[model samples]
Target: MQQYLFFSRDISWLGFNGRVLQEAANSSAPLFERIKFLSIYSSNLDEFYRVRFPVLMALANVPKPGEEVTDHRGILNEASQLIARQLDEFGRILQEDLLPGLKRHNIHLIYKEPVPGFLTGAVTDYFYTHVLAFLQPLWLRDYSRKFFPENNKLYLLVVLTGADGAEETAIINIPSDALPRFISLPYNGTQYILFLDDVLKLNLANIFKHYTVTGSYSFKITRDAELELQDEYEGDLAEKIENQIEKRDLGLATRFLYEPGAATRTIFNLAQTLGITSSNMVQGGSYHNLKDLSSLPIGTYKELSYQSWPSVSPKDFNTGLSIFDTIKNRDVILHIPYHSYNPVLRFFNEAAIDADTEEIYVTLYRVASDSRIANALISAARNGKKVTVFVELKARFDEANNLKWSKRMKAAGVKIIYSIPGLKVHAKVALVKKKNNNRTEYFGLLATGNFNEGTARFYTDHILFTANPNLVRELEMLFIFLGYRQHADKYPALQFNHLLVAQFNLQQTFLFLIDREMQHAQRGKPAHIIIKLNNLEEKRMITKLYDASNAGVKVQLMVRSICRLIPGVPGMSENITVTRIVDRYLEHGRIFIFHNNGDTELFMGSADWMNRNIYRRIEVCFPVLDATIKQQLMEIVQLQLNDNVQAVQLNQSGENTEVTNNLPPIASQQEIYNYVKALQA
Candidate 1:
């Protein structure tokens, strides 16, 4: 057996998904929130199949570039097995735990088979009114190239028998998007829930009355979602992306999923007609695409869900002082979800109105549909302020939204920057320049998350508002590089000493910091490092950390997903410990703390410790120069470290064990909210 030195990226991602399942199983979490966790897990898995599974399939027959093992088929087999087990566990959680738990609270989630007498008549009426209008049944035998199944769309492969004992198949498209997945019953006093699957099953005869539908199996196809933007820099970038979007739904089939106990003949027919081999088919339970559970009606059971934690406004910059003036002399930090995003909004809104504001620049990777940020940029352009916005068309799954915004902004006199040749601007940064009497003053905002206000309410992030002259000057230089100078490598003269810009300085800076810690540990001085990222899979960085662990430096990692580093391995990473925290709010924001022997050096950024972030994308990691702000970040990180309730220690085997000990319960997300609230008070 040729063993790889690190855990496979896909396997590690599965481990992260497993942690999500653990969230659903957690009894301390509220009931409806547990259901939401299941939804998150399903949604996460759906994306994995659409995005990562195709790569696995393509790599199955071909060998990788620098690999020791080229067993992609073997890897795919293992993935299918793991998913089967997880789905079984998922079914158990919904049926055994969630459903029964709902019933105990006077709510009944009618899981599988047999719609009640009252709901049958009421739900059937619902089906006739809402669902029946959109139902389209295509005879599978007559299926051709014109009728390829779209990705992630639900279907029922029916095995039929004619009056003369002939066999046939038809595909019924499930109108999940048009109708709600969970249909609420009209029964008074007791709450009853019904799945769309059961309603369709009961009413199957109403649509296909001519044929004897013997075996109808529910399934959904996941297509390869990798968009091939050929010759990106050569020609119309937006047009190329638009063309790819048209073909996305019809991409290569990577997974053929069907409900468990689907008849062998039905499976065979589906396999042959759909080009799904035995290797591609996965057996799931009654339900598919449980991600829809996100919309599950909580009714009056708001108590069954996690209590709302309203965003707290940062009180450092008073309303009396202008946002620009406050940031002109000091650095203000906003820990989002805990801290309100209003000040960040105020930054741009004020820029739009300020008479002295000369120019505004922003890089948007993903913004909300009705983005107030986009609206602000348009308002600035209309106000005669020169504005340039970079709308990255290469943001996966967000191409269409980006293009729409790009068109709207370009029409509004804002200069729009589309995708660069091979690089995606993954940096979350905004810059504003004010023309003072004698000189030009710059105000810059660097963030660890997107500028979208919608996500700020749930996704944990760090945003720094600064008027630091040196940092702003470097940022101005980088924007010039992006707008006109062209390629990343073409600009080595770009000096970002105060900022860590990827491709130019980020990787090297991180290496230098790790090596310094290792050197200090070798000399028997106090040395340690705490790194927090959404993922940690960059091979070189993992190698550097392994070497540091060998040098007796203490290393602690809080990686939420896709961690390849094997912690606690004797002689390999014995001194390194890796843990994960998944709670009410998403655990995002990347924070790097290096114990500089005494004077602690810290960094927060949009980039993860992944290959794409380190080597490919244009990313920015800014320093926490302000002591008070740095102290706030340190406190937040410490709270996460001390989280025993929703935190789990990950072992080398990829199992997440809860951090149980003789200590008071601490859920970091909830604690951070209170901590910031107290600070404001």
Candidate 2:
């Protein structure tokens, strides 16, 4: 038997981003959509620098005892090279494809070129009026230590000759945070856009009148975003997390991205003065933060972007019947972005005002800024219903928003449970208890994504509404266990037969299911596995999939982000196929299906197959017990597997090879929308 191998998770993630770049480079995509793709790629890379780059740096520099030390530096170099190549393609697509396409539509984006001489006076006057107030220039040599540039904030370093004829350097902060990154200029019948950086470069002489401006280069520093809590078990987790959020921008520098063509000595001096090591210094383009391109003023040129597809209201709930009534009689599933999110909102809103509702329980990993659901929860608490909310403050980059909502809810008489010590409750489940005719009835929602309405419009996910007694009872038990704030081992009575709760029976049940499939394959009965997740990185699960493949159990996987399993490997994973899809909507669901001798078993929830989900967090994956909903979900997965457009196959080397065939094109997102609409019809 040949040995099995796995791809590096980080490198595989970069390859996923490369597929995003492919969308940007595709000529068939709408012009503005292509620009949006470029923005996504840039934003994704910035996050990699902030979050994952630090992990790679730590692994290479500080290895733990007994940990297998591999060539981490080599992996780092490979990542760097891959990003460099992607950035090159990014530049090419912008310059060669997108910019010209914009010009054809009478839009002129002033990129690297100097501001047109005809508009210099207008821009110079506008700059002094609109952009001058936010400028703060400091001499690097005098204030290097005191100047703490915030993470991912843009700055320009200027080389100038002082009045005394001595060479000097000063740093000017780009006020993109305050002012618009892309400024619009008036031109007859044509729209003109300028990067705020170029506006600063053009007007440097006005700000530094005493010094001769020799050159200016744009740069930004990306800091590590990981927050380390000193003690999780002993203190207020919410207060500790709030403190950490305050210090997040001040963490160690991870990358120093600077424009090329700066003098070598000047770069060295700047690094030394700012306490940045040479290894973190990376040569970037003339503009440091292209993520702001997302806001490019594509004024009234709606034709250049994707045509809108109005959200459809599901038929059952739109019939003027109560949402609670619809769920009580049968299980219902809504595919978001295709189906309107009103049902989910109404589920909470009704529970708030319903006379029978006695309690509401929810786990919020990431809450929307102006969440209607959170507002409804507050109302429920105010109306004398027992509302318990588990707000996971450790949801990175969202700690502040979660804290804000948690405080408001607590003030409104809601019982707010902060994150579990040393664990993140990533489950997207909610339970509502009501009294009907003196009998207790429970309604629950198990979803594949967050409860954020804003994200619901762009993330393709599934939310299951069920009144199944078994599932709802198990959900109530899980919430009770969460309220205790103890590890699963401490609460031995908490066992789930209907739902798969991580840190308890989730991993073992999944393994057992895979082994069962292997047994079926050995018996020459029908056997296969179909799983979809945002990421897959757990070694044991991947090994089990390989074992199933060797046992003749066909495996079809839809992993949207980081996938480490090397597919199509002879004698190991030859029977397994991996597909990735990136479209207008983010594929964010986790669905697992196993052919139990042709009577398939399906589950969907928030957990990925990553180690953090399996061992470090309390994730919940529930079985699809209803036959009609199960059939619909199975059909959706089949559509995704059959997708040719917006889908790519992953090879053994983790490259995203395009899926091609002679059959008619089937973009799963569009097809699913049509399928759901027809079902309503």
Candidate 3:
């Protein structure tokens, strides 16, 4: 192994964001849809700074004894450079490509003068009435005192000069949170839009009343969002978390972005007051927070947006019927966004309303505030059913909401289990028990995504509903473990023959299976493996795959994010190939296939090939017992493998190179959606 080639996962993630930017730059995409992609890219980068950048800073502070920990510094420098390059590209595309294209369609984004006379009154009146109330001006003389501006909030720096040339500067906070960013105006047979910041700039003299505005520019700051959680072992965890969330707003400043052509003195003074060092400042174009463009009301230009494709429910599944009876008959798989997620929601709703249901147990990682699943669980508790919900309160950006829902469920008589002290409960599962003719029956659901209804519309995932007794028994035992009532040794009867349960046997089982393939390869039998997951960051697992590859076992991986392994390396991973697919819907399913000397084994579930999923979280992976479902999964993987349009190969240099095979172009997401739609038709 020639020094094991690797790239920082953070930088690799930026490259993935570059793909979204590519979509925005591609003229073939619908005009408004391309704008939406650009907004998504911007928003995704914001969260990256908030969440991941702080982690890198923390890593830089950790001591590594005699070894130099320079990778963190190098990674941050590379990220800063890459972002500068991409921002330039983004600006050029918007100005040269998208703006001109919009002009051809009779749409204009007015910046400087030559305003339409008819719309001037409307724009001025709207700014005076709506935008004036939110403006709070802070003078530079009052700086170096207590002033806390919200992170990532936009502000306009206004510099004024008196008759004697005495200069003073003040900051005008743009209340984008309180008002719309873009204001549309009526033009002569054409539509025009003015950015709210420009509207303010156009009328700054009226607001100041006394000062002559020499120059004004817009700027924004990003803060390090890393929360410093106190060691909860010494005190109340909830209180500590609350304190940390409060301090997050005033965390260390990470980046200070300003409009181009900002005066040198103004930038230096603003950076000093904001506690921003030279290394943390970035100067950019006129606009900040282009992510807000997603909400721009450019009217119903049908030709400028993607055509709506309604979600199609599976042909065999009925929305108005009992889901338990449907699942009892056979296994049903749901492909979300393309296929309706209502069936999975219905599974919980029907169970809650069903008179025979005795008990309901579920593990929730992330859920929406207005969660239908949570409401159903509350209803089940109200109807005298034993309802147990293991809510993970550690879900990032959702901890407070989860805590609120946990309290609500407990108040509704549902037994609420807080997250395990050390581990996050990430499994998406529900086990329902019912009484039929004096006998107890169980039905379970396993999924690759959360029970969040809002995300289900844009994320592609899989849900398996089954009445298999063996799996149901294991699920029941797992819930007991979550409740902290039983240890691993107490669940001998819950031995898994077809399910891979994390924290007990998942890692070992996967290693055993890989070794089995390796032995078969050595014996000259046909040996192959196919795995699909969101991330592959477990070092041991990657090494095991390398071991298998060295034994002549072929590996095909479809990883969507954070792949730490370098595939296709000579003598080490020559037989391994890794591909990623980025498209309209997020690919979030996890599947594993092994060619075990002709008798293939296929499994699908919530666990990714990450360390957290294998040994830290309670996850479950069940075999595709139904032969038809197994074939369906196989076909899905095959379609992805054959995809020449959206699939990108993860090369040895960690570059996402578009596959250039001579096959006809196939975009898998569209094809899969059409495939399911045709099935319903």
Candidate with maximal lDDT? 2
* lDDT string, candidate 3, 77-145, tens digits: 788788878888887877788877788888897754455677768878988889999998888888755
Better of 1 and 3 by TM-score: 1
Count steric clashes of candidate 1.
Answer: 0
Rank list by lDDT? 2, 1, 3
Candidate number achieving the greatest TM-score relative to the actual structure? 2
Instruction: Flag regions of model 3 displaced more than 4 Å.
Output: 1-3, 58-70, 111-118, 230-240, 319-321, 485-497
Residue 344, model 1, lDDT? 85
Candidate 2: residue 254 Cα off by (Å): 0.9
Residue pairs clashing, model 3 = none
| Alpha carbon RMSD to native, model 3 | 2.7
Query: Can you write out model 2's per-residue Cα lDDT over 428-468, one digit (the tens) per residue?
Result: 99999999999999999999999999899999999999999
Model 2, position 224, has a per-residue lDDT of 95
How good is model 3 by TM-score? 0.94
lDDT, each prediction: 0.87, 0.92, 0.82
